[model samples]
Target: MKGKISLDLTEGSWTASGGLTFTKASDGRTLRFTGAHGDLAQRSMLVDATVGDEATLPVDLSTYELDMTKITVTMPSVNSPGSVEGRPFSTTLKPDGAAVFSRAFGTSPVPTGSSLATLAGRVDVVPGLG
Candidate 1:
């Protein structure tokens, strides 16, 4: 649940343009999403993602299992001029064993911990457990 996530940036094809210009500003650049490699760790629940695309993974968040619900995307700030931050978004798991995740900014997006209370059902089950 709590660990470092490293994205394989080399595997994906990212396009870079320019940043804002006009007055004391560099040309605004846009880094679009391309591809990804999820769940690097064998114990972790990995999910592959792409730009303009969405993916879902059944993460077992119970009993300290490795579950990756989202990604931490770092991008240049358009509003703040120059900065970056975590943009956690929605990740839903369906009753039919399907999980749906999204990344709007085309960057690494993390799962919303606040909305994961219900998603904590993918834990491992013991053989003799009732």
Candidate 2:
């Protein structure tokens, strides 16, 4: 399956637009996002034992207990540009064709004591026949 994904930050005025794909596998499923660029260049992968059975087309965050080590984020830097690797996170594919990703940090970055980042927006899903 293929789709378009978008995300906006709750704490700041940052956004990302991208394309998403889901490929079936014997073990489980593989979810991928690409064409993403904005305040931060974002790309993600979720390799879980389930194919998001709870997820419905055009909405619902295919819930999964993602492998945290597989997540990565790239930030723009003046001196040196690099990626911050390996952070605990979870994702919720919203019902309105959007996906929400929340990252948890060991230390609180926001005074409100929420997640380090909360990204939510629409994702257009297009089903493909096997």
Computed on alpha carbons, the lDDT of every model, listed in order, comes to: 0.26, 0.33
RMSD (Cα, Å) for all candidates, in order, is 19.8, 14.9
Candidate 2 residue spans exceeding 4 A from truth: 1-10, 23-78, 81-86, 98-130
Most accurate candidate by TM-score: 2
The TM-score obtained by model 1 is 0.18
Q: Write the per-residue lDDT of candidate 1 for residues 1-130, one digit (tens) a residue.
A: 2223334222222222322111112433222222222233432222222223234322332111223343233432444322212234333332211222232232222343423322222111112226
What TM-score would each prediction reach against the true structure? 0.18, 0.22
Inter-residue clash pairs, candidate 2: 60-93, 60-94, 60-95, 61-92, 61-93, 97-123, 98-121, 98-122
Ten consecutive residues with minimal summed lDDT in candidate 2? 4-13
Cα lDDT tens digits, model 2, 34-103, are 4333222233322212224443222222232334345454543556443434344544333221332212
